[model samples]
Target: MRITNVAFAPGHAAFYFDDQAAIKAGAKQDGFMYRGQPDTLGFEAVRQGGEAVTILLQLENGLWAQGDCAAVQYSGAAGRDPLFTAEKFIPLLEQSLKPVLMGLDVATFRPNAMRFDQLDIAGAPLHTAVRYGVSQALLDASALASRRQKYEVICDEWGLPVNAHPLELFGQSGDDRYNAVDKMIMRGVAALPHGLINNIPQKLGRTGGKLSEYVTWLAQRIITQRSDVDYEPKLHIDVYGTIGNIFDNDVVKMADYLCDLEKRATPFELYIEGPGDAGSKDGQITLLGNLCVALKAKGSRVKIVADEWCNTLTDVVDFVDARCCDMVQIKTPDLGSIHNTVDAVLYCKKNGVEAYQGGTCNETDISARACLHAAFAARPDRVLVKPGMGFDEGMTIVANEMSRIMTTLKAKEAAHVDQPLQTV
Candidate 1:
């Protein structure tokens, strides 16, 4: 089959990550600066809706495969213009890459011929969102070409075992989806308000008090509650490097605070992500490693998850090689291609670093389902709930995909068991 026509359409996203953010200190269109970031993005106004663009590829085979692309509803906070990304990305595809991809054999489309993670179509670094959409379209076509599920294609290409089990997932609830409250009480899916960027005092709605206290109360509440599942709900928090806001980048103070937190949240461990971001990549790796080491020395079981500066497969390798954190959230979009994502997971496995196949609330259903194959093939420690942050939408997609794959495996096993005995 040959590529025939490439098209793009603008749409609206069903989910917005901006609601909870606007309730915090930064309420203006030009409010809140991510630490170490050069600009201030308007994260507040996106509550109305986020920009979504749908891509359709018409092929000579008379079949079509769809791709989804959307920036965070809070694009203003990132200092990006949504319309510009939409326009620039589609043409970049038509000009630099589409010429090569169009009319090419679907079976022979080499995905890594141009690596978006390292370069841009023009003179600038291409946004991961744009790269993500095209990469997904090609992946869908590849699966169609191979007569297999998209995830299976990656599994086969990387030589990952097909029968590996599904990855246990963690969810973070937002807006109208308040399952985190119930899920926590049931000791179900682990939830963090905003990973590291959330304001503990604000999210919990107390005028004055320490973040550690709220975390303690949260831990106490969850620990006291029993559940059918034996797993203790972890109090995972992503600081967005704002822990430094509380302590001014004092790693020693951060360690001391964690020690106190350990006292209250006993038996229930904490997975703290980006407690503080050191200004540079090396600084971050070293700082995170130092925190882990300090916690280890104190016999504190708190786990550190690296997020901010760890954007690509190379970053994953560096962080894992340096023993930066106990686990790495492999944000799938940043890889730009499924092949590199597979490589990142395998690298984490080879080096003994625990992995989490992570995606954002900004993704779509197609992308969400595609992630399931990776989660099962690699069996990462956790897979993030996706498509949207709403508990209903996200849980449905992730749970169904996991259930579908695992159920298929069981059916196959049962068929084998029922087979008549045969001579070897």
Candidate 2:
């Protein structure tokens, strides 16, 4: 089947926080509007407009998909806008990609051929964000055309297993680290408290001593609260490279404390990610080695997942090949396209390293659905999903669509397996 049409929904609607005020006024009882970032891609806040943006695509076959491209909604913007969100590139999807995608054979589209590497975003007329949008829209449209879930399309076309529970980087939470801990737990996530205490002094309203005591208290509370839940929650404390840079003296001591906490919370695996700043090549390798050594000394089998330090598939392959890390977190946007991310996961698997399909805090259902499919197709050891406890709209439809596509693909494979051999 060919794509007959591609369309985006109307622009984002204005949102008001009347409910928050009502709660403060005691007009509401059950829940209060706790201000946290809205779910979006990383760039929404920085865009000239202060509105959340959502892009919807409708295929000729009646298949529909929507993505939240607003940057600030998803990524908290710790640093500069990632390459995908460069200012000059945002308009192509809003204007160009869709028209180009119409009437293309969905099933036969070759994803690799559409790679954006050749697009001169930094030179000539093409813009980086625009090219990135083209790639993303194409992937979305292709998935719709094939009637395949985006993740399954990526896995079938590209060969990677899905990782269910991807790592989330938790930056400083307002004034209280405990608040961050509580937020994660309430969201049904086991967290890694990386960099929270390490940069306490620099953070607003926090002292080093208070931070250390809070970490100890939080660790103990987490361990004690284990039996209270139906399934034991996972917890990993991130040093976020603060160990080597600012808290060198406390690095080993903190590691020992976390190790002890892990023992007390036995059966719940803990992951230590980015023990030191890993922006540089040598730093990544050194941190990986140090993490492995510490875990070994503690006689713990908890995994070490590399995030910012392991940026690409090659980095993941090299780290796993050298037995440097236990897990690698792959972000779809960071990888550019779904196909590339899948390749990265496959590479990790080939080398016996676990791969986790991670999500940003601001991701909407479109991206989240894609992540779910990736996880389902890859079947990683653990998966991270935010359940719809209060929202009422869970990803049942998206999940069903993905499951159907996978079933169809499996049936096709079985039929091929049973077919008689033909002479070439």
Candidate 3:
């Protein structure tokens, strides 16, 4: 099938975009908003409502494939793309990309996706968010044209085994660390509260006592609230480099603190994401590499996850090859094309590094669903809840999509198994 028309609509994402640099540089919280000016360019305030554009491709056979162009919450930080406002990008899509989409064949996906992903405008590629959404639409179109699922298309193209089973879901708590943890526990998420520990004073504490107490509380709370006695969820928290900042970026001191936190989270595994940001990709790798060695030397089980400065497929490869961290957050939106997310996950798993198929809360349901398909095909170690910070909303969207896909795949397999043999 071929794409007959291209249409788009400006829309809002499930969450807000926050200037990560501004927040890390001491932007005070002002009741769900930051009380300071934005440190990043293209941002008017420290926090603003996130926006997206829903791109719909009308196929010649009268089918519609949809995708949402959205960016991460911490836009314009850690070598990421600038903020993605629907109005700012809609014209580019219309003038530059819509014509290209109209003439393309939807019988395949990879080459079409790469065409848009690598399209150069004025000697530069399109914005990551634009490429991201465009690729999703192409993947969806390919699936619809072939009468197959998105995950099936990915697996078929990449020559990977189709993983019809559900992946482990990791939940993020935003700022509602305590209450959100309860919800995640009750829901039986394999990975518990992300615990946005970005700040040193408020969340991580001056001497790191506060985070220790919080981890202790989290462990106890899980034991108290879990209906299943054996539901031992791994405690994964994103510190955003607060531990490194508080400890003066000293690898030894950070290792000591991480060991302590691991003790507090006894009988449960702990993963700390972005433990430190060295402000540059090489610097981050060096710092995390040293910290990893230190943790191993100390016999600490706390796993470090690379986030900042690790934005692209190349970055994922570099970080994994360097052996800097135990797991890599293949942040889907930052990687631009959905295929990159898939490739990154497969790469991580192929190597010794674990892949966390992660995206942003400042996404939409469309992007989240696309991400889920990629995750299913790639078979990442765990997939994150996206499009929102609310524990329930993101969880429901991801869980339902996973359930539907698995149900359909199982039925299809059963039907194939029960079919009669042909006269071959």
TM-score of each: 0.82, 0.64, 0.97
Candidate 3 per-residue lDDT, tens place, 2-115, comes to 889999999999999998888888999988988978889999999999999989999988999999999999999999999999878888888888888886898989988877
By lDDT rank, best first, the candidates go 3, 1, 2
Error of 2 at 193 (Å): 7.8
Runs of candidate 1 with Cα error greater than 4 angstroms are 17-48, 72-88, 91-97, 108-120, 175-179, 184-187, 190-197, 200-210, 410-424
Residues 261-317, candidate 1, lDDT per residue (tens digit)?
A: 667667677787777768677888988888888788877888888875677778899
Q: Which candidate wins on lDDT?
A: 3
- Can you write out model 2's per-residue Cα lDDT over 195-307, one digit (the tens) per residue? 32224344311223443455456667665554455544555554445444444534465456556555654565666555555556556777666767776777767667776
Model 3, residue 157: what's the lDDT? 92
lDDT of the candidates, in the order given:
0.63, 0.47, 0.91
What lDDT, from 0 to 1, does candidate 2 have? 0.47
Model 1: lowest-lDDT 10 consecutive positions: 31-40
If the candidates were sorted by their TM-score against the true structure, best first, what order would they fall in? 3, 1, 2
